[model samples]
Target chain A: MENQAQRSPKRRISKDHWTAIAFLIPSFILILVFVYGFIGWTGYVSLSNYNSLVPDFSFAGLKNYIYLFNDFRFQADLRNTVFFTILFIGLVIVLGMGLAILIDQKLKGESIFRNILLFPMALSFIVTGVVWQWLLNPSTGFNQFLSVFGIQPKWYTDTTILAGFEWGSIEFGLPVAIIAVVIAAVWQMTGFSLAMYLAGLRGIPEELREAARMDGASEFQVYLKVVLPMLMPITMSVVIIMAHISLKIFDLIYAMTGSGANFVTDVPGVYMFETTFRGNYYANGAAIAIIMLLLVAIFIVPYLWSSRKGDK
Target chain B: MAAFPIGKLIKYIILIFFAIIFIMPIYVILVTSLKPLDEVSLATMWTLPSAIDFSSYVEAFSKLAPNFMNSIYLVVPATLLSALLGAMNGYVLSKWKFKGANTIFTIILFGMFIPYQSILIPLIQFLRTIDLYNTIPGLVLVHVVYGLPITTLMFRNFYASIPDSMIESAKIDGASFLGIFRHIIIPLSITGFVVVAIWQFTNIWNEFLFAVTITTSDQQPVMVALQNLSGSQIVQWNVQMAGALLAALPTLLVYIFAGKYFVRGLLAGSVKG
Candidate 1:
């Protein structure tokens, strides 16, 4: 009976279907023109090397791709993206779920906790970036404050060798940028994830919790085996959404690092822009855009299908 | 019904810890903004202001010349249009099943994840081609298209949750498409519209990437102007933090009013990613 309730009522499905279709045209046009249309146009442009202002692009036939392989920053961008993805997706989900679980319990000032957690979600990353830059800058930020306590938090420090590898590689390294991006994004989004987990937690029947408590299951045990598994759908949704955001991150990196970022902090979206419009490599930018879009699709469509299938 | 005092204590501790982490940087920014330049030390960026000062807030508003007003101008109209159109689109897509309906919805949902930067160049090019790129009209068009998927999705899901028999009854009474939406559906769904408004308002108000890229002038939006003026002076920390706070205040004020739905709606409706 509960499961039956979530479904759209079957009566007048046909009429509702028609209305849905009618109302859908504008969005359909947006997707058709902007989503696919951009890709199609970009594909055409990539083939012709139109660098700036629609320069007469002669067909280059995969030259851009070949050039990209050799392009140092391109390779660095891909690697940085993967690293950023792994960290952002990982932390946002773990910390998000962690924070979510911690807050799920009915507590005093729970709403206050929720508000503080969610406040960052309402901030523009451009603003957040400025805040973080100030927070991280060695000369002006809390890093400088650390000096008063006899601990220096240097924004740009030389690497120290460790075991077989070098530590704190400043040039061509993104330790500071990575920390800044992850901290800011997680602070902003983990609350979102927490909210999601809370939703799932709310959906868990009181009887279930009662049953677990009745069985002498410890609080941690009940959560580990019961709440955790039950929260899978929420977890999946959180991961997928975080992954999508990680892939498309631009404002924070763009604002913090600016144009002179030691070739570090370049993600696909940034590279895509750098290639597409900034570099005037429209097709390559489009190609980059396509890849980023596909990455997004890979995360979203499957999850949708999986959830839908789960429903069925 | 449960009285686990220890668990309650633990929960409070954890919540307090995260609350501190969440509010710390914002607190630091506030303190920094409120302190005068002379009171600032080379160190102790985390310390409280020596004296309570309001000049930063004043300068941020007055120095920038309607600094706060410009953001409201752009955000209010944009939010209304985006949410309105989004609701309309969601209604059509969810209620009407025609050819390519699912496809259309899916693609539009896909737009949810498209980074504003990936298309920034081409979009700028496209916008410039029409001379609407830098104008508010141009930004409005972009925001509408971008805002559609989420807002529409919200309306769609909410509309879907409503019993279909009620809709059929409205239709059987000779209600037309607009008639049902205006009289029957929209009347029942103020919450969904409010959720969309909150989401849209926050998003557009806090938006930076497109605001930075599309609008070329300091006269555009608070976000653009704030960033443009950030380091214009060697270290105008007071002004910058104040500007940042001013940039944050409107949305924060909005959030304070309806922060509950900010969490709730995010969990229920899909974020565009």
Candidate 2:
């Protein structure tokens, strides 16, 4: 190949180059149209007055955004999403790391426990939502069973707000109803963070632990000072990934508790879906989507940039 | 490595507790599905059914049967087409390096991160324009298109592990690009195909947003159908649980039999990318 390339570099370059281009062309076109192109179109729709059943592409110019910011449902969505993302990511990290540590103890039936934990990751959020819905039903399901123990709680229907404080056009506090959704989200995603942390735990050399022990560090001290620091990068990845999933969460919330009592579990993704399809508020939905994209971008772009830099 | 007996017991207790927490919902679903409708109350959620009943499965299966078939039709072809496209893209991007190839790869990779909601409005419009709206083929096209980024990333990373000299040698034998991909790349990447296929199959099978939005009732996938089974005013807990299980069975089976590969796919899809 080297000798032939030297003999006729031009012919080889053109033929191979075209072939490479040919192979890439289909994907390129599809991605360009579907991903990039559709995003552009969505951006356009967000700026237009394309509300109602009929398509009206007249210039709206941030009107929809302004309306959504003022709208009560959208405001509640923003608040719910913020609290959900924090609580969901926090719980997933803690539970995931704890489980990783426990499983890393070289216990019996490690694969059984790992597989059981990770199996939830295999099911759709839709299925997870359904099962969780039944389990968390305020009147039936676990409530009935738990009532025997003198414990009765409105699982997802609980709309009590904690740390309640008034903010500009929205209540800035944790909506308690989100806890059920958070539990469901954490259950499904803990496996992902667990897998990551487990791999991170395994990658840390045993010699380091021995070294820590030789320095008179206790087991917990070694974990805190050495192992924890080593797992920082994995934790960052987990946070970003979990944050992204939480920000765009739809299926579980949609299936489990549709908007909850008084929209306590309402999220931007659900609101966007309902507005676009059910209410025929196309432009409003587009605005919600663009906001979601921006939110996801804030988490993802930096990660992608750093990963690209690492690649070089 | 030895701990106090008390500490070891505590560890076992904690592990068992979480294991129960994780498994309880599944257990409830299983037991609930097997109970007769009259006995399917939340109070009996933990009880053994007096008699095993397959009636719920029969009812759920008959209702979900069409949608289940839709998921199969959607998953198989979508997986194959995307994997094929990804292999070709991966081969070229990794082995047949070109000017600005890295830029192109990065651009495509960006597709993986964009929230799908951001594009749905225009995606529906585009589908309607192409006359594939509300059809199985339309959903397939959407899945293939949206699936391209991750699939390409997986295959590219996989093919990168293949030494470039293999391609160079194939070239030396007067093989064209297609010839090399067909013989050298395809044969070498069977495991790659399996990984990508499993990833895509589970994903497409379990995907809800596109399945719900793109196709109406008759064309709906099982995931959407499963959601619908519980949408009525009067809920049948047994049938709903049965439907949920039936819907989840394929992916669950995949995770059970080929869990290692599934985890590999997850790691490859996330950790590397």
Candidate 3:
């Protein structure tokens, strides 16, 4: 009887562990094959000489990467992505933080205002793109409305490089045409940062603010020092999240502007799509994909690292 | 206290100004969508339609009808399957802790941050190899795989809130693993399921990159179809606006009714990650 009791408990525990692992097995296999396995395959393809529609797995060194780095369209895409990221992140933070503060003032019809601001977030970026495409049409849409104020500037069609300079066969300047695309992006994503900032603001204890007030700090001082510093973590989260979205932005740009005049608004994501599917430059596209992955990794890997450490 | 009214007034002015900027595009689209073909012009953009018109909607709906169905067929099964798989994975990771469970989770969660563009080439090649290219099932599989990281994180965090003691007590009763899950976990996770469902539904519905890449003409989801609608020559502003509204209606309704859950899911997904 004693032997049976001990054996039964051990077997039950093993059985439980086995079942638990069994539950994870399906997800494990799928993620392994789909995420990690496919990533490895892409890395290999990036290093190969497979430029056609056919799958030639024969190896070539970093030649494809070199070719892309020297390519004008790719260079333009790099420049556009850099400018877009800077402008998009800058505007989203400003607008989102600004709106959050405005709403936090305990305005009347708070939910109504909040809903209106956030409603855009619900629509797909494609829809946002289509809507904004029409609105920012230089000849029509918002241009006509703005003409009443005498501000009729070419929107997406404008390819003038502001503060233009050249470096290593790439123009290092803001493409004015990308600004229209940026506006649409900022409009769609500002709600996210707004919500995050509002949450972060709400999380601050009233006692902290009251204590600051008792110390004779002005309202601006309180926000500048206490509230903004307190919101740093949320801001980091917002930046990393927005950076990922911006780096891989496709649909909005694709629908809003197709590679723009002079490829001014072209991004790597759209470039990769067209190059691979439209142009059938498969190897070149793979190299672009790898470079994008490396850029995202630079931002996200460290984030995951720090966040994991924080969790511990 | 005496300065309060002026402060409040200034606050209202700022709020109203920003609100107007935020609502302008939506207002333009709404009005433009309602305008008849000839009335849809730059000058009339800010003006309300002279008369309510449904003809643009009629035209857009007929054009977009097939792709709209495609989106439905794609989103429903994809959401359910991903959520179910996430629930299962969450049950194991949280309730049934094992060696390297956290490590395994961190690995899976890392998948969420991948730009996905990185994997497109191989993903396409693999799908073609498997003969699933240009099919809805192929897109569904891609979504489910990519969605695992976020949904797993969601359900795991959710299940963590359910005390481990419940599972311990159930285990002490000689209930098997499946029994404990079927009896205890599933019943308790109805709200978790709802939140995950809403998140996945919105995401998969709004998703364009995968849908655009994975599916071709007939199999294209509504977002891609919407893009195609505008891509053709001689763009009809009224019809296009109406098509945009039609494409947005389902998710817009979800946001309207379940805005609370949507926000909750967003917070949970981002904050936890």
Candidate 4:
């Protein structure tokens, strides 16, 4: 590297380039050391059983992974994570697509709508999780409030007292966590999807809409038949990002339940945190992380690639 | 025209409905925050406060004082310095077109999706080894690494869009790289650069996971502290709500002030590239 720098003396150097390099080097080194270096070290640690409060290391290869496989909590957490991602991705797309369609209507006060829609997104995770947790806490939140209105609805603890759906059981666990977090997330995310979708809507040629109208299509028919298909690219954009978010969802669970080891609601990220930091099993935490990485890759890489191809 | 009016009205209705539902949670939070502590306890949380009270704001400010300052102590300098340096990287890579530039960009893009948790295990140890663990700089470095990719990518896209002829013209006239950048590029790219800066500022300000894990104190970021307050259930709800508001206020203010930058800047990468 030094030799290349020395050899490049005749290459008409500029302070801008030097400054740029200088500015970037710190961040580059930070990422390289903290991210890549740590990942490589995690790979190493996964091979050993590193316990907490002990400045010791051992070399036990693949046994940690094997134990990780046999661990029921790990398996259950895997299922819970998959469940969260599926439900979250599904709802965000449906509701987000709906919001995008509705908001895309060059209506009144669009910016106000946009800002209100986007504002919740600015709340930190602690705020997001705590707010949602308080609302859905059943005894002290929305349900209790509703009870005073002569409508005692049991929303969060299952039994879908929402007047339409009957889930048949009152389970206050992962299902509630998923539903609660998704509502909070959707409250925060629909704006993002709406923004992207509005951009997509704006991108569509006005001629297409007029042409649909000229074809004797009603406005509803035009929106349904002509506009929906055009929104796929933007819809995919929202899905890919939200899918990644849904996968490593730790903050919501941690803020809600404080990482309880007893009940369910435990996603892989939380499990990894507890397994490593709280439980003193660093190797096992690495194993959980490896699994999380694999799961995210399986979901996101394809979406980004296909979208890139979709444009082509 | 008659049929069009009906359809348009329906669209407005649906949009308003969805918007209301979307903002309902935040509205709930606002009302929750304004209620008196006793009123918040005895009364239902969904309704408006019987009377406005400011004591909870005082309590929350005090409870959140340590972490609130901790967040400022970390996010401000971290965002500014990172953006400054990140722009340099973006500018140099875009303008200089040095060797391995493509590889560097590719690596940065790859870094975007790599799960941060995977790096935490070794990071804790590495931080300990280097004595950077549990410190503001360590946490800021973590944020810088995360912040650099998107910000640099943004600045690069924006800088790349600036015509090469202007830069070359400056170069031919004996304008050094810095001179060209200072005179031509930076000024031209200021809007986009500020856009990226705002994005990085909001992001670093809102971050919780890294701050919580990397820094081991109640003096973590505001988000981490808000989360710790989550456990003290007997803790005053008004104060809790107030803390939540205080923690989120700066980012909200930033978003409001930099409205265009946040919207346009957030979408800049996708929009420009």
Clashing pairs in 4: A20-B88
Weakest 10 consecutive residues, lDDT, candidate 1 chain A? A158-167
Model 2: which residue pairs collide? none
Q: In candidate 2, residue A268 scores what lDDT?
A: 97
Task: Show model 3 residue runs off by greater than 4 Å.
Answer: A1-13, B1-4
User: Per-residue lDDT tens digits of candidate 3, residues A1-312?
Assistant: 643454363454568879899989889888888888888888898888888877788989999999988888899999999999999999999988988988987777999888888888888999999999988988887788678899987988998989989865867799999999999999899989989998989999989988999999999999998999999998898898899899999999999998987899999999999998788888888888889988888998888878767654
Root-mean-square deviation of candidate 2: 2.6
Candidate 4 lDDT over B1-273, as tens digits, reads: 445587778777877787777677678778878887777763477788889888888888888888888888888888887677667777877777766666666566546667778888877777788898888888887777777777777887788789876776676699876777778877897787688878877878887778877887654878888887767866777677788888889988988887777877667644426
RMSD in angstroms between candidate 4 and the native structure over all alpha carbons: 5.3
DockQ in order: 0.52, 0.74, 0.76, 0.53
lDDT of 2 at A294: 97
In the order shown, the chain A TM-scores of the predictions are 0.82, 0.93, 0.94, 0.79
TM-score, every prediction: 0.88, 0.95, 0.95, 0.88
Clashes of each: 15, 0, 0, 1
lDDT of 4 by residue, A7-41 (tens): 47597755656665675576677667766777788
Q: B1-273, model 2: which lDDT tens digit per residue? A: 866589777888888888888999899888889998789876667787999999999999999999999999999999999999988898888888776787788888889888899999888888899999899999999999989989999998999899887887778789988888889899999999989999999999999998899999999999999999887767688899999999999999999998888888887788764
Whole-model Cα lDDT of every candidate shown, in order: 0.71, 0.90, 0.88, 0.72
Q: Model 1 off-target regions past 4 Å? A: A1-23, A144-150, A155-177, A259-261, A274-284, A307-312, B1-8, B63-67, B98-100, B231-235, B271-273
What tens-digit string does per-residue lDDT give for candidate 3 at B86-197?
9999999988766678878888988888878788888887899999999999989999999999999999989989987788778779988999889999999999999999
